[model samples]
Target: LVQTWKDDSSIFAHDGRLNTPYSDHLLGSKYCIHAKGFEVNTARVGDSLYYGCVPVILADQYDLPFMDILNWRAFSVVVTASDIPNLKKILQEISPQEYSVLQANVLKVRRHFQWH
Candidate 1:
């Protein structure tokens, strides 16, 4: 999938190490991919929120940190494992106007993800 979407400007799909620092990349990007690692939850989501980047969460059964108080759908894109192949298409379908709303909401809820 990375190979197929490498040239697609809207999608920053890369396989290996990024030339730019990871934190810098997060600050510049509009969306950050938060795939589940060994655990069902990871700090990737929080990191994305901290940097004001909307999260693209790829988890089948994640109990998002603040599901009760925050509307995850407002600021993040939750993609199922079944839709991995169509990830790019799903993200692309989110118009720039909608993305702006998502990013704005990310800032609004970022404090919830902070330690202090």
Candidate 2:
């Protein structure tokens, strides 16, 4: 099941029971989708890395954090807005081994996203 979080609508607001803790959700999920927010970057990407959930970035021409120092592809998947329709097929094409490597890289880079 694909789980998403959006707070724009009050009807979808969590009353608490149906809500899995954010950290828990990340820990349990294999992939986390991080779309651009009002800003070019959002905390969702960092949160995904912190919990070792491979991020699927759905932003076009948006600069990611630590581009010079870190190879984002080692830990995450990036897709253009135009490719949104193919997202499922693209992700599904990733072999299990590749996914494992991505997840491992996420763990390696988790500290970089943390506040000292």
Candidate 3:
């Protein structure tokens, strides 16, 4: 994937050449990819919400925080790890109207993901 997006100007690929501030990237993007690391649990999801970026979580069998209280589907896009190859298609299939609702819900649920 790194090689595939290396020359793509649209992607921030983050190969050390993209030295912009992390907050800048988060705030500027509409959707943040929260791909799982070695551990299933990561701070990316919360971080995305904090910056008002809708999270595109690509983790299988991973439980998101506050699942019982928060309807994650309303604010974020949850895709299985197996669907990584089709990620672009999946995201594109989301209508603009649906994206707006998701983004609006991200703002509505932002307070819940914060420490304060």
Candidate 4:
């Protein structure tokens, strides 16, 4: 699957969902939150969480609720504006143990985020 954040413009003046291009674009890239401005909660976030691709969020604000219930710190890796290059390096060097833990963390949050 492939998905372009669709809102990564330099000026940052868009208001919409950043659908990761087609799923094919996501084949190996994992997941991303490359939207321009604010970041509350996005479908891509849920999709990546649900899909276990380890979301790479690019939003300035990671304002998510239920932090106590869901373990973003445990499962996913994040890169701030200055840390993108390091983030890429981390992606390339991720250990199997880390990957497995991330997957497990996703499952841990599954029941809480699932549709009723």
Q: Specify the highest-lDDT model's number.
A: 1
By TM-score, who's the top model here?
3
Q: Distance from true position, residue 108, model 1, in Å?
A: 0.3
> lDDT per residue, candidate 2, 1-112, as tens digits?
1232244331122334555577887787788877676644557778888888999888787787788999998999998888977777788899999999999999999888
- lDDT string for model 4 (3-102, tens) is 2223533222234554555453443445444532566455656666665556665544567657666667676666676665454466668788877887
Would you estimate the TM-scores of all the predictions? 0.83, 0.79, 0.86, 0.62
Model 1 C-alpha lDDT per residue in residues 2-108, reported as the tens digit of each score: 78678988778787888988899889888898777664454778888999999998889888886898899999999998998898889889999999999999999
Residue pairs whose backbone atoms clash in candidate 1: none
Task: State how far residue 36 of model 4 sits from its true place (Å).
Answer: 5.9
Per-model C-alpha RMSD: 2.1, 5.6, 2.0, 6.5
* Candidate 4 ranges with C-alpha deviation above 4 Å: 1-36
Model 1 error, position 103 (Å): 0.9
TM-score, cand. 1 vs. native: 0.83
Candidate 2 residue spans exceeding 4 A from truth: 1-18
Each model's lDDT comes to 0.86, 0.77, 0.81, 0.57
Between candidates 3 and 4, the one scoring higher on TM-score is: 3
Candidate numbers, best lDDT first, in rank order: 1, 3, 2, 4
